[model samples]
Target: MSTTNKLLAGAAILVAAYAGSSWYVGKKAEAEINHQVNEINAAIATQLALSLGEGEIKLNVVDYDRGWFSSKVNYEIRIKSAKDEQFQFLAQDHLRHGPFPFAAIAKGHIAPLLAYSDAKLLPTKETQPLFDAAKGEEPLRAHSFISFGGATKTVIDLAAIDYRDEDGNQVLMAKSEGQVDYVRKGGKEQADFTMTFPSLSLVVDEGDLHVQLNGMRANGSITEQDKAQASEGELHIDQLGINVENSTQIFIENIKTASSYEVKDGLLDSTLTYDFGKILADKQDLGQMQLDVGVKRLDYVMLNQLSQVDDLDSMDEDELLPMIKQILVNKPEVYINNFMLSNPAGSSTLTSDVRFATTALDPVENEELDLGHYVESLNADIRLSRQMIKGYFSGENMISSMADMFFNSAAEEAQEAGLVEYDGNEAKLALSFDAATNKLLLNNKPISVEELVQILFSMQMGGGLF
Candidate 1:
């Protein structure tokens, strides 16, 4: 053969080999992606079954484009209610992914890239008339772009949600952007996230009732599950501002909260601290309030079980009360570090330390459960700042009159019994429960819990007992 013809022949063979290899890789990638998609669909179906009891979820990949180094998928997800098949929620997604990462795919790992998602919730035939009456539309939409990266897998999602009526009148609108991080360590999953919403607004009653939020932001981290079969986390909120105008005008600003929790060896510990920066009523400035609470040795099982109730609205009280009693019997300790309500007018603080134990439950004969037996095991010390009382009474009319009535009825008795101790603007009183006498004590003086409740009720009843 001629030298030129030999060179061309060699080149053609090389090109054919390359094309064959590319085709094989492309086929493998397609199969891998379809397998991963099926796994995800199965997971979604399982969760929906658990949540809706008998609901069904279906996922379909309608379009797919495969490339040597990248791929794209267009898929649809549909969910229908168990009770009413016509009630459905639907979503569509168009995802463009980076290189196939053949090695990861072989090991059953898949990564997602920047993707667009849009969803809608529709009414069923049984509920359509109500929706129509409310001037609602079937094509309400919430759309988002999701991008993921990180050695351990992280996701950054930006979303816009909107709901409108048939007339194209917006009813609700919101926008949020967030980053969520996930990592696995020591056989446990750990996650951290931060999210912010620049604006959220809702209009109802044909614009008669409107609520708007300027901004809201939050951050948190948590262990999904620990060795002791428990989860722990901490969360912080920078601010949540809301303004509402209707029959009454209301506004709130900078509502911040920080909280943490941990569970181990059948015990749960938690703390919550919050501050309401400011609130306005009819454009009147009402100063902020703060609170600090702590719980120790709380029954972890009880809390977890309570949290697992997927539908509380469907739960029967008769079936719930017994569980509550059983949980109380497990005994949990509680502490109140500080609870303060403050304003330009006045401020007060309350603090308490208490532990509960239960040996027996009082019998119930188709009536209310008598919790007196359980009270025998409680020991508590609660203190209230006399300043709070003074502040409440510092105002005229209602509070002052009520204070007068209370002091007239109990002040002398309390003093004679040494149950009342005063230091400047603070009052300290100790509370205990006595099993032998079946009595609840205030500063060593026997006082019925019922009586204390009565006193508080009377104060709020226009300064007189009912």
Candidate 2:
């Protein structure tokens, strides 16, 4: 062969080799992606099985298609009771992911990535109408994103959740969008999530009673520093208005609330604020009302654990009381840093710190403990405005009548002792519990248990408990 012919043959061989190597690399990349996805599906199925407890679950992989750099997967999940003839829950999901880079897999790392996924929740034939209504609103779409092996973030968007029947028509309409981030660090998993309902409205209409909630927008986020122990979160609402037309008419407008909390090392700190911008009853503007509260050193972890009882629905009182006692004994100190309520009338403030002296707690010995024994360690401070009382009792309700009678009986004593002053419209009182004498002091004056009971009885009976 001539020199030119030999050079052409060599070029052809090199091109063929390159093409074959490319095909092999593509195939291997596809296999690795498929394997990871299948592992995820299997883990999901296992979790569903565990969550079902006594119920049964079935997972079906409907379709899987692989491409050179992309893949699609479709699956369905169904659950049914052991005795039931029909499925109790059902959902179908479709996922499309990738531009899988062979280089990343070879390097043992997958960088920032996103997958598009959507789902449909199927209802039984009996509840078809409700499900139809939901689907008619919009399809549920979710997108998953992963960033540098740090966390998997999922974003979901939905139009509405609605239902209708002859007895009542109910609907929750909103542009609901949410994001959830799951991260793992040091053998512990945490989640930080946020959800927003931009235009939320809930309405219920029946024969005579028609209730509606409108102009409700809310967003919230929760961050768990330690899932088993600590978390911090906040929720904010823009506005919520409610109207009820029935035997009694109620109208509330511009209701807003904001709350946040933090927990770490067995101590919890929290703050909450609520505002009733305006309230109208029978078309009478009551006024703007607001409340604020701050708390610290609360046993939030124990409280959360106590709230999350295993199989609580199946546990009877005989099996529950001891659990409650144990939880109370293990509870840590709680301090109310500040609590204030303000309205058109006036404002009241309260602060308190309380803790249990668990000298009597013996979890293994099964000893019955009385919480009252620990109450004597609490310390409290209170301040109230006389206008606050007058505004509360000024109405023509039954409570006002009781308050009037009680105040009349105490008028002479209050005047003689000069303990009640209306000029400043404010009153301050401090309370402390003395363990040595087992006495409770009010304004540095020790009061007997009987006297305390009478005072509390008068307050409750006269509608002063608020």
Candidate 3:
């Protein structure tokens, strides 16, 4: 062969070798990524079993394409971790391909979590099993890309991302060509919510949903079990924002707390403070008022707090029941403020304190006390003017019995004549409470504890009704 031909041949062979090596490197890198993903999937499954409950498991990656040329990667996932469980998320364009600020461009080098769950995407979320968290980037300075970028420079963005693990954990991600908006609408009949924002912002339309917890750590079995033991139904939102009245603009600010909540049988667990802003109904209308609430509990578990009070320790066993019952009736502090209710008799905006506590319950005789769980502070202010009771009570038979007892006692004692006419009439009473105690009120006169109890029972039995 000619020398010139030899040189040309060598160049051709080198080019082919380089192309083959590039292909081989890409294939190997993909295999390694899939292997790591599989490992991550397994860890997710174990946690799902522990957190959600036991169930069948499957993790499927529907599509995975990384375009180093485009500085982008795209993927999709479908997962079913337990019985009757399935969901999918799409993550795209995690890397910003266009020009950005220095910090944004530099942070883009590291991979961001490409997928996160939507509030309503998984209906059985309360029973959804847990998945172990994949390794993540550490916290950095407060910059636009700081939270979701890599530690080094030379960035690549994600085009689409999706993940589904055996533990029922699912995620989705996607990017837009320029800036795109996202809107979510949820609920049936009521049109529960309508929240929208740009492509990068997380949004929920309402219903039992939570979003923006892209960085929360998850562990423990995530298997779905009996509904009884499942976590409360709720939307778990870590960081999110919303926009009302469809428009061309988008805002993803006002991220809420590191909070979680549950709802069951129309009951709510007061775990998160999501409603912090003044809620506007539409163009120019106020819908909800400013409200700040603290320490709310359901089912008034008297036994939990009753055992902690100063006087309950000395109370005898038999005496405890009566005290507990009476305390619940008059002393328990279950309340709602800034609400208005109306009855057939009248209506009023409510403004008052209420209670079922030591000040309202009394013992007819001296007894040992053992109060271990008593609420020390309770107060609420209503935004409305008055509050009311809506239901009615029956007192016919009781009224007659009391009338007869009165006449009988008077005749037997001969302290009064046979009843000619009685002023007794049935009256129902609702109450508003106000007062504070101070053993340290060195100069203030204190109401006797016994007097307070006597007034409560007497008020309920009739003294203050009129």
- Candidate 1 lDDT over 1-466, as tens digits, reads 9999999999999767655555555455456446545645644543342233445566777777765444455565555554545433333332323333433444344553222223343455544543454444433333332223211333343335465665434544344566655554466655566777677676664666667766677777656354442223333333343334455676777777777766667666777787778766665565677788887766656555554565557889887666666656756667777777766655656677655546444355555333355554445444444444444445456876677556444544444345555444444566666565666777677777666565555544534321
lDDT on C-alpha atoms for all candidate structures:
0.54, 0.54, 0.32
Candidates in order, TM-scores: namely 0.58, 0.62, 0.29
Model 2 ranges with Cα > 4 A deviation:
1-89, 100-116, 120-127, 135-139, 148-150, 160-162, 182-190, 214-229, 246-277, 287-321, 334-339, 359-372, 382-384, 389-429, 434-439, 448-466
TM-score of predicted structure 2: 0.62
Write down the worst ten-residue block by lDDT for model 3. Answer: 187-196
Ranking by lDDT: 2, 1, 3
Winner on lDDT between 2 and 3 is 2
Where does candidate 1 have its weakest 10-residue lDDT segment? 143-152
lDDT of 3 by residue, 130-209 (tens): 11121221111111121111111112222333344554444444421111111111311100111222223233343122
Instruction: List model 2 lDDT by residue over 77-176, tens digit each.
Output: 5555444445544444443333333433443546523333345555556446655767675435565544333356677776576666676765656567
In model 3, how large is the Cα lDDT of residue 19?
52
In model 1, residue pairs whose N, Cα or C atoms come closer than 3 Å (at least 3 residues apart or on different chains), thus clashing, are: none
